[model samples]
Structure formats: C-alpha cells, structure tokens
Target: MRLNLQTDYALRTLMMLATHGGQLAVDDIADAYGISRHHLMKVAGRLAELGYVVARRGRGGGLSLARPAEEINVGSVVRDIETLDGFVECFDAGSNGCPVAGVCGLQGALSLAVGDFLARLDRYALTDLIPSRQLFAERLAPTSPSTSPP
Candidate 1:
C-alpha cells in the first residue's frame, strides 16, 4: 500500500507541526523539509481548513496545531488527505477495467487490507510516533528550507 506524494507531504507537514508545538512559518517548514513551499502551503491550507492546524499573520504569526498532539489521530489525518480507499485497480469506481471486476476475490482482499491499515492508524496519534517534540525537530533540522508564498 503506497500513499501518494500529496498524502506523504501532508503527513510530513503535520509531523513537523506536531513537533514544533509553537508557531512556525510556512517558509520554515518548507525550508526544514527541503520541499516546495507552494505545495506545503496547499497542504497547510488543507490542514487549517480541516481544523488540524491554525494559521496566523503578522510578525510573530505562523502555523501551529489546532489541538494537542495526543488528541490528533494519525488515521484521521491520513483519511483527510487520501482521496480514495481503493487498494486495487478493480476497487476504483472510475476505472474498474479489470476483466474480473465483478467477481474478483483480489478486490475484496485488498479492501480488507486497506481497512486494516486505516484501523491501525486510528489507534495512534502524532505524539505516539514521536516521544519528544525536540527530538523530532532535531531529526528533521538537517533538511533545507524553502520560500513560502506570501
């Protein structure tokens, strides 16, 4: 099961914010991760819209998690970013071109696997993955930063 780049970036962005706790500029996040500020801004906007993070403007303004790390479920974040739950070609409603689309056990099995994956994620919060925010920051600090959109 592979997550798309958008989802991957969303997760990374969330992890970064989760670790920061305090306010962080979008530029700092992009720079820290060596990712495109434009893409990260889009991700940040989605996160803000979903109530996962909040954004503020001004000299000290930046972004931060809306809730405590312990309250934010990792599974919920992934679900918000993931457009489809389909694991196999037959599972997609738009393109079920497989010859055995209607009678395939593969589709059912894959669905089960995807469900299990999400279920496991549901059991964890961002804090569960990283014990210390400082540690997380230290681990991610080596990456380059990018310029965020104003």
Candidate 2:
C-alpha cells in the first residue's frame, strides 16, 4: 500500500505551512524540500481548493493554513489525497472483473487493512505529528536563525 508522490508532497506542504508562522511562497516550499516548483504549485493549488490552505497572489502573497494545524485531521488529509476506492477488485463493484469477486476473502482482508490504516490516522491531527512548530521550523527551515552559522 504505497502512497503516491502527490500525497507525499501534500503532506510535506501542509507540514511546512503548519510550522511557519506566516505565508510561504511556493518557491520557498519547493526549495525547502528540494522538489519541483511546478509540481509543488499543483499540490498547493489542490490544497487551497480543499480549504486546507488559502493562497494569495502578488507581492506579500503566498500560502497559509486555512485553519489551525490541530483542526486538520491526518486521516481526512490521507482520504482526500489518496485513491482508496479499489483496494482489491472486489472493492470496486462497477469494474471488478475478478472471477471470484464475491467468494474470496482476499478483498475482505485487504479492505479491513485499509480501513484500519485510515482509522488509526483518524486518531491524530497534523499537530499530533508536529507538536512543536518552533522545533520543526528550527530543524527544517534553512532560513531559521538558529540553523545559520556565525
């Protein structure tokens, strides 16, 4: 069960936003993670559309979390970012071409596993993973005063 890079970038972007106190330019986020600005832009756009972030254009404009990190559920984020509809052929009733679509336990087991994975995520919010915004900033932000050398 691997998550696509899109989801990974989404998480990273959210984490970056949560730690930084102010609006962050898309280029800054791309540079921070050494990812493509073009790709990051797409991710940022989707996040903004989902209401996880708010984006502004022009000078002094960028991205910021729409709500507090504590209010954003990791499970909901995963659910929004990942496609979980077809864990196994049986899960997708419309196009399931498997011969034993209803007779096998494989689909059921996989479904349960996928459900449990998401269920566990429901127990935590983004803040749960990054409790100290300052600490996250200090370690990950290249422009952090603490990370700079004398």
User: Mind giving the per-residue lDDT tens digits that candidate 2 earns over 1-150?
Assistant: 898788899998899988886799999899888899999999889999899999999999999999999899999999998889966667889998999878888988998899999999999988888877788787676775875788
Name the candidate that leads on lDDT: 2
- The runs of at least 3 residues in candidate 1 whose Cα sits more than 4 Å from the true structure, single-residue gaps closed, are 142-150
- Considering every candidate listed, which one attains the maximal TM-score? 2
Give the root-mean-square deviation of each candidate in angstroms. Answer: 5.3, 2.5
- Local distance difference test, each candidate: 0.83, 0.88
For each candidate, give its TM-score against the true structure: 0.85, 0.89
Error (Å) of candidate 2 at residue 125 is 0.9
> What's the TM for model 2?
0.89
Q: Estimate the overall C-alpha local distance difference test score of candidate 1.
A: 0.83
